[model samples]
Target: MRDRHLYLLLLPGLLLILLFRYAPMYGIVIAFQEYNIFKGIMGSEWVGFAQFARLFRSPDFYEIMRNTVLISLYKLAASFSLPIILSLLLNELKHLVFKRVTQSVIYLPHFVSWVIFSGILISFLNPIDGLFNAILANFGSTPIDFLGSSAYFRSILVISDIYKEVGWGTIIYLAAIAGVNADLYEAARIDGANKGRQMWHVTLPAIRPVIIILVILSLANILEAGFQQVFLLYSPLVYDVGDIIDTYVYRVGIQEANYSYATAAGLFKSVVAMTLIITVNKLVKMSGQDGLW
Candidate 1:
């Protein structure tokens, strides 16, 4: 009877998973079929990799794949480093009130909708009379079309993503840092270690496990570049640099109504992501560390 309460508590969550997540897995079958909404799943003809073949033959496939992987890699590297750097910098702040205030300000952007953020970014980066361009004018430089230009689009995407997510990322690291033993720091100080030395030797080592876990989990999401950010910021002109798989899927599948093609593309991303997660987890285990089980 004591176990009854735990089962009851878990029942709701389990039901939600079945409804929202597992139920959607059936839709993945559309990738292998000539999917038609009117004909439905059972009635649809089995195309047997026809859509995947079409996708591979498409002229844009290689470009989109290259852009997606490169953008995702850039975002991964920046996002991974930014949070750790923020947490470390914030940890060194001795003033509690100031630290809390700074954290709150930085984290506030994460709560804003990407739509609103995109609008704000467009206004700020506008080539004519925009604040950023205005500042550049002070240096006697021509205004840069940051959002529309292919050269600047990916960098802007990377930096903006880092800004919005970095603060929220710090929360996890901060929690890990908080759990570090103060006694270790005290001992380090007693041994004539400075603040930087103590942080390098003691605090970093204490939080290494948490860092490794987050890194492994992040590897699983290597295919997921920020969809909303990319969709909003990118124009046809910048498509070379800004086109990622998720955005490309939306454009081809949802906008163009190429359902089977979209499904195939999405399935490709999922398979790649799953393989990466499994490979990375194995690597971590080989290095004598725990990873996703």
Candidate 2:
């Protein structure tokens, strides 16, 4: 009875998840059906495994999967490591105002919607009159189409992703780092450790659990290379390098209206993602770290 208020505090979030997250899950049935718009789920013709088989048979499926994995891995690697380095550097800044200002500057990009951000990016990278081309022109070089070029698109995606989210990840780690015992740092200093050594030995170890948890989550979500960002920034020329599972689903499912096939593609990605979370969580537990459970 005493905890009733605490439970009340949780009710809104629970209700939100049920309404927006779990409720839409019923649509997963479309993966197994022809899914006519006029005929509802009950009235749709069922064809077991046909959608999956069709998806597997498509020539583009392998290329799409490969691109998704590669781009996701690129983002994960850069996003995961740079934040730790940044957090450690930020923690070392004894000047309180400077640290706060630096954090605010970096964190500002996280709030910008991908739509607006991508427009800014597109304008900056425009082959004819973009900021980058103007810079190149100053040096007497021809303008290069950064976004359209397959060679540069993936790199741009990774760099832009880092620019946007690295600070947010750093904030999480800084919070974790803040919880480390001051005595641990003192002990490290007493043991003749320099500031760098103290951070490596005391700080990083203290936050290993948080790092592990984030890694597990990142790995599980490895299939989801950013949909909105890619949808906005990518062009047909760069689609060979940039098309991920989510974008593919939007094009085929939403635009082309091949609902069943799209659902099947999405379902496959979800199943793989679920398996990844389970497998990675189990591995983390085996290595004696706390899993998400």
Candidate 3:
């Protein structure tokens, strides 16, 4: 009874999960039914795995899978690594004021919503009187429709993602770096280790556990290819390369009113993501790092 107040403090969060998360999960039954807004869940026709079957049979499924995986891999390589590099650089800065200012400037874009950022991106890559096009004109180069071209769309996605997230992503790594023992640095200096060698040997090894955990988490979400960013920036011209599972679900579900199909697709994604996390966690544990479990 002495800890009753502490338990009370946890009540709201527990209730939130029960009500908003677990309660709403009951609706997942509709994924096995021919869901109808008018007929409701109880009244809907039970289709079993028909929706999943249809999803597999669709020609667009393979293409969407390819695009989703490719884009996600691009982001995993660029967005993930850049942040570690940036955090290391930030930690090495001797000038506190410059470091703080640089951090603020780089992380500022993370506060901007994708909607507003997309609008800004659209203006710069318009290809006709846009900033890039104007610069190209001065150099006697032709205009390029970056967002409309399949050739450049994925690159743009990766680059813009890096711009918006790289700095913010560094926050976790920076925190981990900060927690590294100062005595390790002193030992490195005593051994005549230079700055770069100290960071590589002492700093990085200290934060290896954190990096591994993040890598596992990143792999778990490998199917999520940034729906909002792609939806805002893509057109039919680039859909061949830019269309992902989320965008596909939005189109097939919201636009075409295929509720059951959409649910099946979403559930499939969730299962795959869960499997990824489990597999990665096992691999990490085998490699001698602690797992999320």
Candidate 3 — what's its lDDT? 0.94
lDDT of 3 by residue, 35-154 (tens): 999999999999999999999999999999999999999999987789999999999999999999999999999999999999999999999979999999999999999899989999
Q: Is candidate 2 or candidate 3 better by TM-score?
A: 3
- What's the lDDT for residue 87 in model 3? 94
Global local distance difference test of model 1: 0.89
Instruction: Return the TM-score for candidate 2, rounded to 2 decimals.
Output: 0.98
Q: Could you list the CA RMSD of all candidates, in the order they appear?
A: 1.3, 1.0, 0.9
lDDT of 1 by residue, 186-282 (tens): 9999999998898799988898888888888888888888898999989999888778888888998889887888999999888988899899889
Give the top-scoring candidate (TM-score). Answer: 3
Local distance difference test, each candidate: 0.89, 0.93, 0.94
Give one digit per residue, the lDDT tens place, for model 2 in 47-90: 98999998888888888899999999999999899999999999
TM-score of each: 0.96, 0.98, 0.98
- The reply for model 2, stretches above 4 Å from the true place, is none
lDDT at 173 for candidate 2? Answer: 97
